[model samples]
Each structure stands twice: as C-alpha cells, then as structure tokens.
Target: MDPQNYPSMDQYNYSNNGGNNNNSGYRNQAPQQHQQQQPQQGGGYPPQYNQGYQPQQQQQQYNPNQQYSPEQQGIGMQQRGGSGNEFLISSISSNPLAQVGFSYGQSLFNDGKQYVDSNIGKYFSFSSLKSYFNVNTSYVFNKIKLIIFPFPQKTWKRRIYRVGDVDSYLPPRDDINAPDLYIPLMAFVTYYLLYGFQLGMGREFSPDKLGTAISKGIVGWLIEIGIFRLGSFFSNSYSIPIYDMIAYSGYKYVLMVITIISSILTGGYISFFVKIYLVACLGVFILKTLRVVMVSDNSANSHHDMHQQHEGSAMRNYFVFGVAMLQCVILFFFN
Candidate 1:
C-alpha cells in the first residue's frame, strides 16, 4: 500500500478519464481564434489581395495609353505667346513684295512688245534662225575647185546644178552636201587668226582692236544670215535651211584667208586681183546653186515661157550679185 498507490491526487485531477484528448482539442481551437483575429488588423484574405492589386494594375495600363485633350493643346500653344501666332499668320499670308515684282515684270514685257511692234521690219529678228555646220569632205573639195578654178563642167557634175538634181538630192533624201560645220568652223578660226596676224603686222594689235574685229565678224555673220533669210522669203521657197545658208556664207572666209596670206607673202596687187576674181566666182556659184535649189513647180513652166521667167531669173541673179557685193564690201572694210 505504499507509494505505488500514490496516484490518487493525479487521478482526481482528470488523469483517469479522457484528459489527453481534451487538451489536443483546446490546442486546435486556439490556433483558429488567432487566425480569425488576424483578418481584422489589415491582413489580407485571398480574395481581398487581388482586389487591391487589380486597381494598381489598371492605373499602370491606362497611364501609357492616355492622350492629351484639345484643351491641353490650346494651353501649350498659348504658353508660346506671340512668336507662335506670327509663324501661323506668316504661313497663311501672301507676300506683298512678290506681288509688286510680278507687276513690274509684266509692265516691262509690255513695253518691250510695244517697241518691237513699232520697228518690226527694220528690226531684223533672228530668233527663229538655226544653223548646222557639217559639210562633207567631197563637197568641200568640189567647192574649193569651183571657187579656185571656176570650171563650170566639173563643178556642175559634182553638185546639185539643176531643178531635177534638187529633186533627187534635197531634204527627205540624203546627199553629199548634208550641212556640216567642220569646214565652216575651221575656215572661221583660220580667218580670225589671219585677221589677228594682219592686225599685228599693221601695228594695230591692241585689245580694243581685237575686240572690234571679233564684233565685226559676228555682225557680218548675222547680216549674211539675215540676207539669206530675206532671199528665201522673197524667192518663195523655204527649202534650204538656215544652217545650209550659214555654211555657204562661212565658206567665203576661206577665200578671205587665202587672200590675206597672199597679201602677206606677195605684198602686191596680186592679192587684190585674186580677191576680185574669187568674189566674182562666188557670186556666179551662188546664182547657179540657188537657182536650182530654190526652184518651184512653176519654175519649169517659166523656162518654157522665158518672157515670164526672165524677171524672176533676173531678180535671183541680182540678189546673188548683192550678196557678192556685200562680201566684197566686208572684205574691203575689215581687211
């Protein structure tokens, strides 16, 4: 009966029944009470956690895509003040200076037109004239032969000499005399050089003299072109182009060069005689060439009626003579 039976006080305290099971139930209930108190003090539940996070996400999404209203744009423009308003006005308004300049130009153009109209015929306009300078080597050789020797038979055979020949060789058909600038250009340069040489020898080789010579050459060329244009207009045939006439006119420079060389070498009337002879031959050549080339359908009929054609032929010869006389005059004056 000793200490072995001494559990009496503990058994009375609940060790004899289900005391251990009750203690375990109290532990579980204590944790549930703590969990219930946690939610009342800002601790998030699973559903409430997403509710706060959702608003933050919405703010971030809208921030990047937001646009300023028109009212905001107006506020920005007003902030720039007068400079912005000036730029806008300048962009919309037309310039007064530009309008004045246009009116001035129109008045000047009208004045020029009036002056041109007042002196139309005397004012010889060459606005529509064109020139080509490509002469064939064979044609050039023939031209030289005709000018130097004045041999009628051989020269006539070599070039277009008759109305029928013109029909065979003129434009719409290619011929030996298909306008070339080579001989004409070479001749012009040679003439210019010879002229300078002559001036140098004459002790009149100032810059002003050289300029005068060049201007004279240019004026002479223009006058020659004008003369030919007039001839074509009056002859009633615009068959030959301005370039061909220019080529023909430039050919005279070749003779001029030769005469100058002869004058420099021989220093006598020999040069003068040669010039006279060449000028005469050139006139005859032009007469014959232009007569055939400028032929019309009525020209052949005129041949049958010589009385009717005589006046036309005479006029053509006179025009050729005038061109030849002009050449002689230029030679005398310039050389």
Candidate 2:
C-alpha cells in the first residue's frame, strides 16, 4: 500500500473530532431555529404541513364555570349528526316489507280488539264482577262456616245500598250475606283438585278420568243454572240479573268441595253420609238465599214495600223447594 494514501493517526483523530463537533453544533442549534420560526409559521408547523391543520383554540378558550344554552348543545348534536343505529332504524322503517308487516300487525290487533268488544264484551262486564273478588281471609272463613252450617244465620237478606236515589245491594265485602263468585270459583277449582287427589290415592288417576270429572262438574253447573232460570221464570220472578244467578248457582261447588274432601279424608267409607249432610245444608242454604232474592224488589222501593207482591206465593215456594231438592241429584252426580 502507498503511505500517502492514508493520513497519520493524529491527523485522522483530529478530522473525526471536527466532524463530531459539527454534528453536535447542528443538533444544538436546531431547537432554537425551530423556536424562532414558530411565530412566522403561525402554529409551530411549516406552511406546507399546516395546509388544513387548526389549533384547538376552542379547548384552549373553554372555561369550566361557563354555562351553555340548550341551543348550543343542540347545535353540537346536529353537527355530530346521526349514528349507525339511527341509519339502520331509518332503513328498516323505509323498507316496504317492514312497513307492510307493521301495518298488518296493527290491523290484526285492532280487529281482534273490535271483535272481542263486539262479541263477549256486551254480555260480561268485568268491572261489575270485580266486586266479587274483594273478599279477605276473614270473609272466606266466615263464608265457609256459613256454607257448612247456614242455619245459624237468621238474616239471609242482603244489605241494601240507598244513596242519592240509587238503590243497590252492597257487595260481598261489605255484607256477609251478599252473594259472591270468589268462594264458588275457589271451591270449584278445589273440588276438581281433590277429586284428582282421591283418584291419585286410589292409584286410578288418569287424565281422561280427570277430564271426565271436570266435564261432569261443568254439566252439573249448567244444569243448576238452567234449573234456577226455569224456576225463576215459572215462579214469575224474572227481575234477577243473570250474573246474580250465576253467582248463586256457583255456590253449590263449595259444598261439593267439602264432600270431596270428607271423602278423601275418610277413605270413601263415611263420605256418603257426610255428603248427605252437606247436601242437606247446601239445599237449605240455597232455599233461604234464593227465597230472599225471589221476594226482594231489585228496583226502587221504600223499606216497607221492599218485598214483592208474590213474596209468599205458593208457586215461588214450590220453585224454591224444587231447586233445593235438585241439589241432591247434582251432588250425587258429582260423586
């Protein structure tokens, strides 16, 4: 190698130190130069870099104590605009199939409501029947006692409400003597359950037999209603409401439930005699209660004239007796 091609060691070190000093000087001056050019560039960035850049002057100017108006908030929300969810909802609402489905569902609901209002609504007023369910535990206990042994109660007449020329019978909640559907409904349900339980105890439980039992119960109930309606018609007492008749007819289920329970507890041995006694009690109860309803005037009348013209007529008594005696047939049929 030629000696002149490479420098001496001391000269090489001096050249390297000079290059390092230049690089260090340039690095030290860069920040100062950048600081000096910031005001000219308007935001510490070059003109080319700041083509669309904006400083967050609003954030810098914000004051925590400032109160914003609803108008300002609404404007901000408008600027933010609708999200993906809003767009999807709008799309669905604009769809022809979705619109058609919505219209069809609304029409179906309306048609069903109209049909129900036109058909069964006229015959049954649920609002009036709400009073029948207002019974409490105490009322239920007393009612059960009355059903079992109604002879102790001397007053079978329902309490009358006379306020501002409006005459009506007090609800069962207010008057113990008043007819209610609650006990009857509960007893009816309990009778079926007890009958099923009795079948279960005997290992003879079947859904078919249970259904048969329910059918029999319903038939018996309908028959009783028919008997009452016919008896009222024949006896010349047609002032009673059909709802009242229904409540009255339903009460026999209470005695039926008792008979079933007695049968269950006694293993079907003493049940026959117990059923006879309960049937008799139920018959007496029906006789007395129906007699009062048959005689009392449902329309406007003074206390003296509350009794109808045929209060103690033979036909009325005979009808009442016949209704009472028919309960035995129904009870045995249930068994």
Candidate 3:
C-alpha cells in the first residue's frame, strides 16, 4: 500500500518491451546496410528488385513497334512469294480444258462400261465365237446350239416362246436365243479367211485376190440386203428391221464356210454327199425361219394353203427359196 514498497508499472512495462523494439530495429537496419555494401553480381538484392529486372529484360527483348532486320523482312517476303507461286500453279492445273478432258475420259469409261453390260451375257454373249479372238468355252457351246438348233423346241419338240429360256423362241431383243453380231461377224471373217487359205493353198495369193474376196463379201451383203428388202415388201412383213434381215442372210455364209471347210478337208465323193446334206439343211432352215419372221402370222398354220390361194404370197416364198438355193450354187462355185 505504501508508494516506496510498490513496484512502478512504467518501469516494468519498459523492461519487457524495450528488448523486442531494439531487436526489430536492428533486423531492419542490418538488412539495408547489407544490401548497400553487397555487389549486384552476387544477387544481393530484394525480391521486388530481381522481379523488376526480369520485366526490363523482357521489355528489351520484345517490342511490337520495333523494326525487323532487312534480312528477316526479305525472308518473310520470299516465303509469301513462294506460297503465291504455288497457289498460281495449282490454279492453272485446274484449268477449263483439263477439267473438261477429265470429264470426257470419265464419260468414255462410263460408255464402255455400259456397252459391256449391254453386250455381255451367259448364253448370248459376244464371246460365243472363237473367231472373235477372245471367247469363252461356254460361248462356243451355246453358239453351236444356236447354229444347229435354230428353231426353239422343248424336250418333247414342242415350241416355247418365253424369253431367256434356252429352248424358247427369241423375240429379237432381251432373249438369250436372239441373234447377235458375234456370229455374223465371225462368219464374215471366216469367209474371207477361208478364201485366203484357198488362195494360199492354190499358190495364187495376190493383193488383187484379197480385193476380190472383199468385193465378193461386200456384194453378197448388198445382194442379201436387196433380196431381203424385196422379200420383205412382197411378204407383207416389212416390220423386220434391216439389221435382222442382214443377220438372217449372214447365216448362209456360215453354211458356205462349212462347205468350203468340208471341201478342203474331204476332197472326194464324201464331200459331195456332205454338200447335198448341207444344202438341204440350209433350204429347210431358210424355209422355216422366213416363214415365221417374214411371213404373216395369219398364214403361219395355213402357209401352204395360203401360198396356193395367194399368188403374191407364193411369189414371195418362191423368191426367198430362190435366194436360199442361190447360196448352194454360190458355195460350190466360189469355194
């Protein structure tokens, strides 16, 4: 309770706080002096000062408004020029003529594809004849069937008229039994080839002989066309297209080739018998085929009866028969 005996509060508080204040002041002043005395090479600086140096280096390294070296500018311009040249060359390659040519080639390829699709089939393909240069074995057999069995008949010898049936009457289109250019072309070629062989065998090969052979074939074709036109007019079946008539007439050449081959192979009385049989078969084939296609269906059943009654029809039949017989005589004479 007495002033002398009580400890002073101010003295006690100063003794406790004075040591902390002096230690803190010493820490702050010691760091500043260390920085001023230390060299910059040893990295003796504040964290803020080091950070600020990085920014200054970055500022020096990159400035958007700074001018590039002439060499760098030239390199950039050269790269741009090279890109522009490549673009121009590419644009020229895509020119109108090149594009049109590509389109034309594509169209030709498409047309060829269409032709193959339309002309190639199983029983009635262009590959049916060996003389075609590239033919299938199946085609050869079918062609033999077409030649030997011109008239369609069932197992019982009854006629069938459905399309695509192997033993049915072909309606001239979309029918396996229908005639095509393969056989006729082969026959025509065979005719000339046979004639050429004959000339070669006889030691009479000449360019003139070749010309004669070609002329003969051309004449025969023309004569067949004329005969077909006249026959078509007289028979009242002008509906048969010219090509059909040509194809029909061309069958005679196949018979002629047979006669020539037989003559060449068997040059005796046996050949004569073969020729007679061939002529008879040719006559029958012409009679039956023409009767159906060139003659009216109204008289199909009563064709013999109608021929007797109708002079014009008789004359037409006689004319067609006369043409068929002419082939027999020509086969003997030419070969």
For all candidates, the clash counts are 6, 0, 0
Question: What is the overall TM-score of model 2 with all chains considered together?
Answer: 0.65
Model 3 lDDT tens row, 27-134: 999999988776454376666677545534334467688888898879988999999999988887879887788899999999997777676642234433322233
TM-score of 1: 0.50
Error in Å for residue 102 of model 2: 15
Candidate 2 segments whose C-alpha is farther than 4 A from its true place: 1-125, 298-312
Report the lDDT tens digits of candidate 2 across residue range 1-335: 99899899999999999999999999999999999876576556667777687677655577789998998879867655666568889999999999999999999999998888789777566677888787888888898899889888899888888999988778787888887888888888988998899889999999999998799878878878877888878767767666778887787788888777787778455988888788888888888888887667333232334255446356778987887777767776656
Best prediction by lDDT: 2
RMSD in angstroms, all models?
12.6, 10.4, 15.5
> Which lDDT value does model 2 have at 278?
85
- Local distance difference test, each candidate: 0.65, 0.80, 0.65
Pairs of colliding residues, candidate 2: none
